[model samples]
Target: MDYLLTCDCGRKHTVSRKQADQLIECSCGQSLRVPTLRGLAKLPPATEGADSPPGDTAASTISKNGENPWSGWRGPCMAAACGGLIVSLAFASWYLLQRVSIDTSYTTEMEIAEGNKIFDLYTPEDMSLVWHSFESLGIGAKEPPLFIRWNRYAEDRARRASIAGGIAAACGIAAAGIWLSSRRRV
Candidate 1:
């Protein structure tokens, strides 16, 4: 049969009576005068100033040692693959902006050159005819004839390509912004 053993610290443990001889101490913070099956088995109730029961001390120690088990650090998405994608899209937008500027410059240069050519191609007599044609075409007095054709090399297919690329780059940047905003775990 199991015999109950009690420590002076008010901890209760069970052991066979044959093994009780090894046990000592009581809840009153007093050591046993004799460690025997009879000496350790039963003790009087708590006196004063004994340490809290061994179990309470053990629990406190365990909690203190454990600290916060959930504490951990999280990483940022800005440092990962999505961050590189954002940079790539930003570069694409810059590339498109440069193209747009080039296209505007080239278009302006071509129009200026064509205006000069149109002036050079006229004579006093031809100017009267052209102005009359402009009126017939419903163009204002200050405007040239709509049918007039002037050519300049700068306003070519390459300039059109630049405008197209700029539009496409703008779409790409929009797509990147959507993706970044929609994503989580950053």
Candidate 2:
């Protein structure tokens, strides 16, 4: 016979006769032991460990023995996926923006010294190409892209973006590994 022992965590568990006098600990995780069937449950055994085999009993995964904070949280379980997405997005965004400025600078420099013979520096976003071309045609006001805006802020932004991307990758990997953990028993 199993007596239901109610724990302070509003959780009740079943105590087998063998485990009764054995100073059975409550599954509620409380650090206290009380003898009684006040608020406990005796839902059959759910594992298939031959010795404790009691047929197939639907055991609650939530009540399993574990100390995971994100045990039942979907966010933590899928954190890796989210982190990977963020890293990819940030990298792509920053790359595109950086490329635009880089291309503009290289081309402008080549055109100034090489005269019309410069690298292909153009983009098809919101007339970025046209603006650059038009601005390049001006006299005395045609400042090279590098000398215009190249400083610590830009480098810092790039570094921070990379750091964020790296963090995201790490998070993604962690989440993936945990999410794919096998439920296959030992």
Candidate 3:
């Protein structure tokens, strides 16, 4: 029979009749003297394993031999899932915020060169070069001035990062789900 022993800390402990005179260790690490037969009679009987200490549950994912059904695979899977998710988010954020700039400079030494002489110098977003022609600056135009082109590189970076992050996060989430589902509770 299980005797319900109330500890000094106000925690109820369940002890077997065989341990009535023994000193039982409570969850609080305090030594409790098992109640005598008369005292046990006064207190109600607790359900077997109902009030057992933490990690000592009769019904759990762990077996009676102190082994989890997952065989230690759950913990690592959880950690990987979490790490992947975090990395994915971080990469995605970084990709979104990343912006690269491309700059091009042109200088014309020609005496009749016009600023418009330099055309099709830069490749367009589609990788196509646009050509330009300058027939007349009326004949003797000055050399073309230096030209610079600026574009945002953020778009590409953001796209890559977002894709990578999303993929990673998805893998992490899937692993986490698998790990959780693989666990069996008794």
Candidate 4:
């Protein structure tokens, strides 16, 4: 269904039967005149798996074995990148929500601690009273058990989100590279 039209510059263009008697531009800036329909039938057919010109569709860039080199992994790599991004967003949102909840809890505890007279004293002499007040309010420990557990869960989610995001970034880069390479080859 296609014919090889060679230009004066020695570049061959694969033209369809419908393009007979039409003018086509070669990559070397030469305008090639396609043969008539009858003349085209005499010309050699465009070889399958031949190197296609730039801007051609993916199907035109098949190799001698009748397979597109980038077809196998390119699609899967992009899909993986998308999947990773979704996972990262889900984990990140969960972590952010948990962080806000933890912050609110901490603020409430701080407000309660601020209401103590020892806190209002604000003097070195009342340091022991401050400690006693904090102990009485159950705020003396470095972190509450509930807060520790929540913080640990949030940290774990954040870590997972970061790892997923990194994987997505890597996959995206790889896919882009493969796409660029395929384009260059074409």
Q: Return the top candidate by TM-score.
A: 4
- In order, the Cα lDDT scores of the candidates are 0.46, 0.48, 0.60, 0.66
What's the candidate order when arranged by decreasing lDDT? 4, 3, 2, 1
- The parts of candidate 1 lying over 4 Å away from their true place are 1-81, 84-113, 140-186
lDDT of 4 by residue, 1-186 (tens): 877777777777777766778776777877777799999998888886444444344345665465676678766766676676666667666665655565424444664676665466678667877678878887644754565576677677667657656765776676677667665554
TM-score of each: 0.26, 0.31, 0.39, 0.43
Q: Which 10 residues in a row give candidate 2 its minimum summed lDDT?
A: 49-58
For model 3, name the residue pairs that clash. Answer: 95-158, 99-154, 100-153, 100-154, 113-142
Clashes in candidate 3: how many? Answer: 5
lDDT of 2 by residue, 51-127 (tens): 22121122222223432334556445576577676767677578547744542243445546664333233335536
RMSD of each: 21.4, 14.9, 14.2, 9.0
Q: For model 3, how does the per-residue alpha-carbon lDDT over 141-161 read when each residue is reduced to its tens digit?
A: 564333421222444675688
**Candidate 2 clash total?**
3
User: Which consecutive 10 residues in model 4 have the weakest lDDT in total?
Assistant: 50-59
Pick the winner on lDDT between candidates 1 and 2.
Answer: 2
Model 2: lDDT equals 0.48
Predicted candidate 1 versus true structure: per-residue lDDT over 1-186, tens digit per residue? 444445555565444444444534455766533246565446433332223323332222222334322232212332333454555556555555544444233344566788989978999899999888988887645653332211122234345546555655655565555445433321
Error of 1 at 143 (Å): 11
Error of 3 at 116 (Å): 8.5
